[model samples]
Target: MINSKIRFVTALALAASATAVYSHGDVAPQEVDTEGLKELPKDEWLSENPYRGNKEAIEIGASAYNQNCARCHGLEAMSGGIAPDLRELTKFDDEYFVNKVRNGVQRNGMTYMPGFEDVMGQEAIWAIRSYIDKRHYEYKDKDLAELYEQAE
Candidate 1:
């Protein structure tokens, strides 16, 4: 039994390590411009646009945030459920926020969010994030800060 267990463990480790993993080395060999890719013009994309910084969009976003995001995320993006607070999305840039929210970070234990590209549309997602930013980070108070740190 012990030998079988050890063999199973070794096989599991090997299988995990043998998976295709990309590093900086993979960039050059694959003709990938890692920096260029990282520096892609997110400002041009709605995902990183900061959502026109308009109050109207924000209000609409707040409604969206409340309706779709509140139950799992929190009352005001504060995050009381299994989901993390959406407020701290400001910690990352537009691309990161957009990609994560849009793509649904499966590795981060989030796969149920469903890609919003078709459903919510890119503009709406950023607006939601922008609203979350204002509520949780931009207009932050003590309680929200504590929540932010908790996520970190």
Candidate 2:
């Protein structure tokens, strides 16, 4: 019994160590590749984001949001149940929000929310993001340039 317990502990330790291991030859940290820009924590996502303050994109996002996410995330990005308020997604970066939407069920989505990557294209996700940002933060065409400058 003691031998088995020791082996179990050893295996668990090894697995954790292996997962944490990173190398430049393997996978280095991800950086923004847009316009020869380097990514800061706050503004990195805005690098490739054409939807940051695009009105048409927000409208499309609203359509997608209403069609798919309104049930749980609420209409206009508000939330009342198991899901978090999507209006808050504006507060998060592109990668974090994208992963959550794509990994819907796995990341606390119930039967109501579905991973939308298949049905919606990348533009749709950005649209949703744009809408959420404007609605939640009162963003506008003029404020967008400065939005990228603000720190978290």
Q: 50-100 in candidate 2: lDDT tens per residue?
A: 656655666676776666666567667767765887655555467777766
How much is 42 displaced in model 2, in angstroms?
26
Candidate 1, superposed: residue stretches over 4 Å from native: 1-44, 108-110, 142-152
Model 2, residue 82: what's the lDDT? 54
lDDT, candidate 1, at 147: 32
Q: What local distance difference test score does each model get?
A: 0.56, 0.58
Local accuracy of candidate 1 as per-residue lDDT tens digits, 1-152: 99999999999988877663421122211111122111324345553544434455566667766656665676777776568767666535667777866666576674656555545555566566657766755545535444333321
Candidate 2 backbone collisions, by pair:
none
Cα displacement (angstroms), candidate 2, residue 86, comes to 1.5
Question: Clashing residue pairs in candidate 1, if any?
Answer: none
Where does candidate 2 stray beyond 4 Å? 1-48, 107-112, 139-152
In TM-score terms, candidate 2 sits at: 0.54
